[model samples]
Target: MSAANKGKSREKPMASLCAGAIAGGFESFATYPLESLKTRLQFGALEGGKPLTPLQALRETLNQGGTRALYAGCTAVVIGNAVKAGVRFTTYDQFKSLLKDDEGKLTAPRSMLAGLGAGMMEAIIAVTPSETIKTKMIDDSKRAQPRFHGMSDAVRTIVREEGISGVYRGLGPVILRQGANSAVRFSSYSTLKQLAQGSVVPGSQLPGWMTFGIGATAGVITVYSTMPFDVVKTRMQSLKARQEYRNSLHCAYRIFTEEGVLRFWKGTVPRLGRLILSGGIIFTVYEKTYPLFDSIF
Candidate 1:
């Protein structure tokens, strides 16, 4: 491609990133309640056992903490997701462009590799504080008298109690889960989209809804397949002031041995549901908004 063409291609990824970030932020806001419930379910109460059904948990959280509680750590959620989505989308596009030049065509496996790289890179930077605050927010909602008041307090307390390292407690599992999750997600979405594009009648394209459906299926599969890692990630990060887990692997083993293997998949239902909803919103907004931005720019 000529320099002008290369510049245009570069601009596309940045536009995709901005569009993906906006979509991710909006989706996170819309699904905060489900996310809050999913986190509580995963981390469990300060005690143990399933104290609340998903609906009961939602009601209790709302009654006790009000609407604001649903949105706890939303700042971190948006920022983290924005960074994750932006990077993932932008990097995926860049990688695809590189692959096209190298191989003369795009393929599903190549997209998977791109997604894996992007996901791992973003997960390391984005998962730590985002998840730390999320756990704290969920923990706070369960208490009569909350521990940390809000996002700032949670950050302050984590740093004070456990230092900066504490905030990144579950970095290991996060990378494992999210990296695989992103790989499966984008790769599957792209592969499916490519298939759909070909299947459409001449002079007609696959609709945005079709793209969303494909993306949501990929998101659910990715989320559920890696959910055990997520359970471990949540537990490791949500430890109380004095509480500690030996490590991610140790935590997984303990949960398997003590709690049973089923414990590893705890909160899978709500998580799958959350991912579907969030994924739908994300892809829909991203696909729709990118065209608008492209036209504007």
Candidate 2:
């Protein structure tokens, strides 16, 4: 490519990332309560039906402290997800440039690869510190004189005590989750959208509502396919299990052996619910909004 074209390409991805961050931040804020609930459900034992239904989880969270407890780590989520989502969309699109067909049309396989690449990139760039802090905040196992008081405190503590390494505890499962999630999400969204459009090349686009529907469908697929990995990542990152589980593989093995194979699917219900809504919000907002950034920058 010419230098001029290369320079132009750089700017476009930057704008897409900016627009994506805005959309992601909005979606994260809107859906964070469900996110918190999902995190709770992922914790504790799940066998014998015991306790902790979704409603019970909600009650427990509120009763644990106050209404504010429900949004314990919302700040970390919003910050991490803004950058993660932005990078996901930007890298997917950027990688698509390399994977597209001669006619510049994206195939399902190519789109999946691009999305996987985007997911890996987001994990490295945005998932580690934010997720570590979020997990630590919500994890009440250390409720007795918590190690970190809040987000800023958590960051300082991790950095001071464990250095940079502490902030990236569950990176293995995080990468697995993000990579699988983006592959399924982008591939399914692209396929459904193209099937709806009845075209190989980009043609007339669907309405905003239909685009949302497609995105939700994709999110549902992503939730189930990657829930086990999500559970591992959450456990590995959360304060409670960080010491219990040695690593991602150890976490998975313990869950399968002790918690039962089905336990790996813990919290999938809330996650599906959350992701379906978030998927619609993300794709709809990003699609509707990014074009404006494209026009301007």
Candidate 3:
């Protein structure tokens, strides 16, 4: 390859990373409130029947703490999402490059494998503290003292009480859901984008809107496909204050036995909505910003 071509190729990953971070930041900001509500709906029910509807929860949260309550974990969310998007997009580019030969054709399964690998790595590195804070914030409504006042409080509390491992309470389910979610989400989005591009004019490509739509569709599929694990993870992490379950797998088994299989998909509706909006925004921003970054850098 020519030196210019190599330089352009090298720039793609960095450009994608920048674009992804911008997109992810916007996406996270937009959907964080719904995400907070979804977390509450999933884990806020008293052990004995009294689950609050999403609207009820939102109303109660506002009544008690005002609108600020809805964004309790926004800090963690922004940081975590920035890292997640950056890594996921950049790694995806790197993986695709590695998989493609000089002919530029990518093999089957390589995309999926790349997504899975990126997801697992991202989950392990980025999920723990942010998730811990998010769970604590969601559970704060039910507590007398509140587990955490803010992200800093949550992190300090986790480390102080249970040490570093405490912050990773549901790491297993996190990895499972995120890994599979990434694999399905990225692979589906890429495949759909490719298909969409094929139908466009010879010298033209699918619009950014098309990419967003495809990404949102893929996000919905990914979230729903791995939602059961998500439920388990939420339950496991949220129960740290309550100590209700031993671990993620135990939490899953307990929910299955006690609440039935349907329990595994609790709050799926809100989750689906959240993912669709978030995915659309993220993909749109990432796709639109990529060219700008390429031109600048």
Candidate 4:
């Protein structure tokens, strides 16, 4: 372990939580436009229109409401992701600490297990409600008679009309998707870091560029592996979810039977664009920021 890892091992979870919040907030702000485009692409078939390319969607969104349209639900996502990342990193670190062996080695499987638990916790505590609101808000933005004026307004309207469960619309798939996402990302990132550094030592730091590359590679792997879950989660959280599908399983089934299997990856391009940068930005920021936190306390 490097001094960084040593500090991390000794530090409390609050350090990683704060560091992760900073990382997640930055990542969300930087990649939100791509996220907006992705959600639109996911709903393309349901929109009853010709499918639009990313550029066309960007043009249309810009025409509709200028750059502001490109960030339709950015505030919700930024705040949600910040809290989600904080929870995820804090729990992941705690889990990892507990899972390490007598030699203090964290095998790939153990790392993946830790990540899985962290993701599930974050999804339930932070991701599902925020995503439900963000999805509905973005959907609202597409309507001529948009109901939501802002994030708080969206939350209020949803709660008023549908009750508290409205904000947890996609809880099932969100947990599944997030669990798989973290498992793959953290494990692959750890393995790649180890391979790059030629060591299996936990928290072995790498150069900035290498860390970014490894994180992006992990993101690509995670995207392809979990896209179907993501599509289902998005559909379940959409404002029309009540009418379109009964539940997460039914939503997935409808997507498969009505749209074809490939529809599960409908937003691949834009999501890929965002996640590639997201993985890099998140890990690099987390790794760099974590050390500062570690040193402080």
Index of the highest-lDDT prediction:
4
| Candidate 3 lDDT over residue span 192-263, tens digit each | 776776778854545767777987898788877988978887887774534677666777777888778877
Error of 2 at 56 (Å): 0.5
Local distance difference test, per candidate? 0.74, 0.80, 0.75, 0.87
lDDT of 1 by residue, 41-118 (tens): 776643666656788777877888888877777887888888777777777667767765443555778777877887
Give the lowest summed-lDDT range of ten residues in model 2. 1-10
- Compute each candidate's TM-score over C-alphas: 0.89, 0.91, 0.90, 0.95
Tell me how far the alpha carbon of residue 41 in candidate 1 is from the true structure, in angstroms, after superposition: 0.7
Q: Write the per-residue lDDT of candidate 4 for residues 1-112, one digit (tens) a residue.
A: 1126642254468788999999999999999999999988888777889989999999998888888778888999999999999999999888888887877667899989
lDDT for model 4: 0.87
Per-residue lDDT of model 2, residues 67-121, tens digit only: 6788888898999999998888888878877776766567899889988999999
Q: Which residue pairs in candidate 1 have backbone atoms (N, alpha carbon, C) closer than 3 angstroms, thus clashing? A: none
**Candidate number with the higher lDDT (1 or 3):** 3
The TM-score-based order of candidates, best leading, equals 4, 2, 3, 1
Which regions in candidate 3 have their CA more than 4 angstroms from the true location? 1-11, 44-47, 239-242
* Candidate 1 residue 8 C-alpha distance from true site, Å: 12
Please tell me which model should have the higher lDDT, number 1 or number 2. 2
Q: Output the number of the TM-score-best candidate.
A: 4
Please identify which of the two predictions, 1 or 2, would achieve the higher TM-score against the true structure.
Answer: 2
